[model samples]
Target: MAKKKAVGQRGSWFATVDGIELPCAHRRWAKKNWPHYHDPFKPTENGPSASKILKYVQAIKDEKQVILTNDDEHLDDEGELTGFTRLNYIAIYGVENVSFDPDAGLKFTITKRLVELR
Candidate 1:
């Protein structure tokens, strides 16, 4: 028989986004693929990005609901939030899709799998 991993021990970090909770690893995966976005010397800078993303998500959860897909518009054409910032957002808030409204603010679509049922 194979040994089973302890609950919460083997899984990646998770955060709540739009009432749904998801693993942070997914965002980390995206960031890992984009090496240039990260500061090689100061890796810890990426840590706070997650919290920022969560704050963004939490503020809009009631109106935006859930995150569904990834889009290029999530970041600026110059690539703000495209690398580590984007990764942190995805990991902490489950915001798969992002858009900006000049009059409003950042708009997002989130994952549904881990939604918290009322």
Candidate 2:
């Protein structure tokens, strides 16, 4: 059975999905929400999986160019069509705090910060 309470402040609930405890806004929202799915491995809990659909993003900061990559697929917003075979680094960002819906496979978003090299 699902539990409901009006006490406390708004956005407060514990998720009990498949015997796994996850905190969320609505407790009942996870009930049979994801039909057949498994939680991804967290960086802290487990190392980044190589099979993930994530790539790298290259950028320069303070004359020191660096390549950063995360465990999530990302899009390039920059309008520069730089050569892909150049000797430059890359960067990557991930969509955080993603929630799953039974019918919906996976849903998440990513926000990137850009700094031009002058």
Candidate 3:
């Protein structure tokens, strides 16, 4: 059985399908719900895999520019491009928690603070 989230679990539940990410609800009050995305790697744990995290860490170590983009296809309210736009950023201070649903084959999100080169 899948482990349920903490008390009053209310958050975004996502899954990946053919490289496309799909979203749904999570932690029903009565039932155990989970995404149905088939994990090709068949990971033993629920997350983005070690290789994914290493990529970013390596970039930070090498002081390489990290590309930033919005997941949405529309322009964000903050003026950030919703689509792909080349934003070269250097000096990543640190990275936040990175996790995902293994059963759903979800694409994990990486949160990091970047120092933009002026």
Candidate closest to the true structure, highest TM-score: 3
TM-scores, each model vs. reference: 0.20, 0.19, 0.23
Taking the tens digit of each residue's C-alpha lDDT, what string does model 3 give over 1-118?
A: 2221211112222222234232321111102222221212334344444666444344433432222221222355986333322222222223222234434332322244333222
Q: After superposition, how far is residue 54 of candidate 2 from its true place, in Å?
A: 16
Q: Candidate 1: where are CA atoms >4 Å away? A: 1-44, 49-51, 71-118
Order of the predicted models by TM-score, top scorer first: 3, 1, 2
- Cα lDDT tens digits, model 2, 5-89, are 2122222122222343222221112223422222332233233333331221111111121212111222247742221221211
Clashing pairs in 1: 66-109, 66-110, 67-109, 67-110, 68-109, 68-110, 69-96
Tell me which residue pairs clash in candidate 2: 33-102, 57-90, 57-91, 58-89, 58-90, 58-91, 68-92
lDDT of each: 0.35, 0.25, 0.29
Candidate 1 lDDT score at position 97: 51
